[model samples]
Target: MGKVKISAVSYTNTLPFIYGLQHSPVMDAISLSLDVPSTCAHKLIQGEADLGIVPVAALPIIPHAEIVSDYCLGATGAVNSVFIYSEKPIEAIKSLRLDGQSRTSNTLARILLRHYWKNETVSLVSGGAEAYVEIGDRTFGKQHAHPYVYDLSWHWQAFTGLPFAFAVWVANKPLESSFIQAFNDALAFGLDQRDALIAELPPRIDFDYRQYLMENIDYGYNEEKKQAVALFLSLMESLEDPKAAESLAKRDLPK
Candidate 1:
């Protein structure tokens, strides 16, 4: 009945969606807010927002979650963002730190360290760890700065053989079909303007915004991405539960 409150990520990757939402017919029917990925998820989980493009790892915990949009922030491989920068090789690293901006990226780092890399002895520290998880705009141009930089999505694809979807449009409750239609139309408009959006950004010599937006970031919320999201959520749930995580840990290392 009232205007719908929607939250979206505030990062370079979401510029197109932001552009779309602002210029579309749906703008009149909904109110929008921009936040970091973790904040967006929190708003949805705490009932402050009706819908959000949220981190996939938070979906399992958001009550009555329903994906409402037909797009996502995903990558087929080597996204060029989302990195684990380490002072030492992964296996030799004893301590690690997480990014506060995303639940999914941090959890993905944990998952890979434990399962994919088979390195469970690495302790996740709050500060000054041997390695740290970083994502989104901040991660741009940092690939060459670290001695060992591991792309989380690339490793995820290796582990699961699935394209990774970091964030998706999800609603905590059902909405009117008409609103949903308008919402989708708005999102489509944004994705279509991605090139123009990139052009408007400040020029950067270190990172190629065009390739990052068009090639690395897969916008479609297709069937394969759906499978990845489902699988990732399931893995996240397992890790969140101590018993299941313990069982998974047991089978992770080679004999």
Candidate 2:
């Protein structure tokens, strides 16, 4: 059998999953590449990787990607990593620069910004901050205390009263049940050894790295996660833009 080519996010939140893969039976059976969230999705869409932990927003961009596993990077509420750090309060913001991390987050930010603070016309451009949103390990504990930071997941809940899913494992094509089982077993191993995995991380990340990994992030693909993903896809489908609507409809996700 050919090696399964998997792409994962190069973020602290994904360390456990990577650690699981490293120690699992699937380790030698797979080849892995790591990239930023947006790049991970781009690589998968370009056919450079067979499976990716793709941003929920980018799922629609790929035509034949399937959910090969029931695992995801998610939070019940207030995922502490993805933040919108701003110089002023979010209500006072005019234009906001998006950290070039994940497209899913960029959309989530916009959705919340519009929903809760309806009076503020926030623009999501690629520039410096009147306010700015940053995700993953890059922003942890390095305080830019000027702008009022908003946790995207928390913001989502404030707007829609639902949990949020960030990224999910998606395969370019379907794999046999045996292979899927192997992958799940690997991930389970990784989750069980959270302390050992955190110890493996290097210093200089500028945060309470271990605590954040163990406490702040929830790495499960439970029923709530499934409902949240489905709701997000539905919202994307309902977008006024026809192109976005068609993209969501055409994504061939596994039932």
Q: Estimate each model's TM-score.
A: 0.94, 0.88
Model 2 per-residue lDDT tens digits across residues 29-107: 8999989999889988999888889999888888697887777888767788888888777888888987777788877
lDDT of 1 by residue, 1-255 (tens): 999999999998888888999999889998899999999999999999999999998887898999887889999998888999998999889999999998999989888887788898988789889999999999998889989999999989988888989999999988999999988888889888987888899999899999998899888999999988776765676776988666655653322
Question: In candidate 1, how many Å is residue 210 off?
Answer: 0.4
Enumerate residue pairs that collide in model 2.
86-147, 87-147
Tell me, what's the RMSD of every candidate? 2.3, 4.8
Query: Judged by lDDT, which candidate is best?
Result: 1
lDDT, candidate 1, equals 0.88
